[model samples]
Target: MHDDPRLEELVKQVRASRKYSAISEALVRRIGAAELCKRATLQDAVKATKKTLHQIAGLYLANAHPPYDAWLRQIIQAPDDTARRAVLRSIMNHHTSTRERLPILDAFYARVLADLGPVRSVLDLACGLNPLSLPWMPLAAGATYHAVDIYEDLAGFLRAALAALGVAGKAEARDVITDCPTDAADVALLLKALPCLEQLDKAAGAAILDTINARCIVVSFPTRTVGGRQVGMRENYAARFAAMIADRPWRVERIEFVGELAFRLTR
Candidate 1:
């Protein structure tokens, strides 16, 4: 998180914007002006405050690096707790607005569920602290969900979130680039993970796609920035993905851009 340039730019934008004015002022008053100067960004300060609040509330979930932590800290320090809670609750109900590129995740779920009828199980690849594909959990009501990811801590975090949401799913420790299970998945989801491959080569990403022997695969790439920040354009992903499945029997069903993200549904 510290090395991400995108994060750095986002922090700068947040500091200069009116959105975080009240929270920033509250933090400076509570934490002191001198302490705020020591940190690189206000987001960092918010993170520290949220840690304290979470510790106080004893609300520990398996989900590590929860984005709500920052929001919670801002809300708690506000003058009115009721209004703060209401605002934060509404934010949580929506997809993370902080993300640079946001695809309509719910629509993708609907399409996937309708496409893959009566699937036995699902394997969600690169599942981070937040499980974006959670809605599909109901489709395979009794099926085992094997969520795999490089972030080892994410497994516990996802397990807790699933439990809290009353979703029955299992988490497995896996690095998609290095190791992908041979277990057949009825459907596979590769969503917004291509940008996280800082060290891995393009071939590694392609390998994961090749290994997922599912009936249908739903993959998406961010097309533009939702926050008006600079990000690497995913210009060649479609061609690369198409090449991987060229020799396969699957047929491409949909390829369209939604907001700043491009989605492809192949069956």
Candidate 2:
């Protein structure tokens, strides 16, 4: 049999990079799940694996719901802070993971922003309705925020919300896997997004981190899966994330909160 150079090289790339080790595991998980999803076929395993991979290669996030767009629009039209916060609650309750993280949003934002002094601009990657939490963030007056998400309708609603609130925030539909946005900012957020990005493309995720022009990058990961499973996720993700930055030029600081893990990186 002839040697397959491409597969050999891919194996070398996966084995040599510790950061990619976690990504490789994620791929294995996907393949196993996909395989089981087609187990009735009992034939053409390669075809099934290939088809499943293509379907997911460019997926951005798992918890996307277009039905929330109307709720976001209502929040933008809210008459007062009391009304807006109430509207925000409805939006938050739509997703359990986001809902859990938001009640402590004030303290969470304080910790992420406090360490990165004097922020004038922000970049929020894969920003779900988290951009709606802008009211709670300790942002400088007139600080410009640029955010992106794959859900165009949700992003459009956020763009309208930013204008309604008189904050200099911009939300646009984007696929970070294909074209990661890079604008200079005092701080850039990757909250609970790295794993998803890596799952899409580890090379793209690493490249996004390497190329983004920001003073600090804040990364957060969930301690519990969306299904409420807590099978060593924190330790597993943290070790892989540390490996991702092992050769990069940044000072790392870790912040731990119940059911969540965070890191502040500055250079």
TM-scores, each model vs. reference: 0.56, 0.74
Candidate 2 per-residue lDDT over residues 9-56, each given as its tens digit: 333443344322322333433443445445554234334544443343
* Clash pairs for candidate 2: none
What's the TM for model 1? 0.56
Candidate 1, residues 119-216, lDDT tens digits: the string is: 66777776543353454334655665768754334456556555544457777656465567767878776766654432234466566776787777
lDDT against true structure, model 1: 0.51
Query: Can you tell me which runs of candidate 2 are displaced by over 4 Å?
Result: 1-69
Instruction: Evaluate all candidate structures by whole-model CA lDDT and list the values in order.
Output: 0.51, 0.69
TM-score, cand. 2: 0.74
**RMSD (Å) per prediction:** 12.7, 9.1
Could you tally the backbone clashes for each prediction? 3, 0
Candidate maximizing TM-score: 2
Model 1 ranges off by over 4 Å: 1-103, 130-133, 136-138, 225-235, 260-267
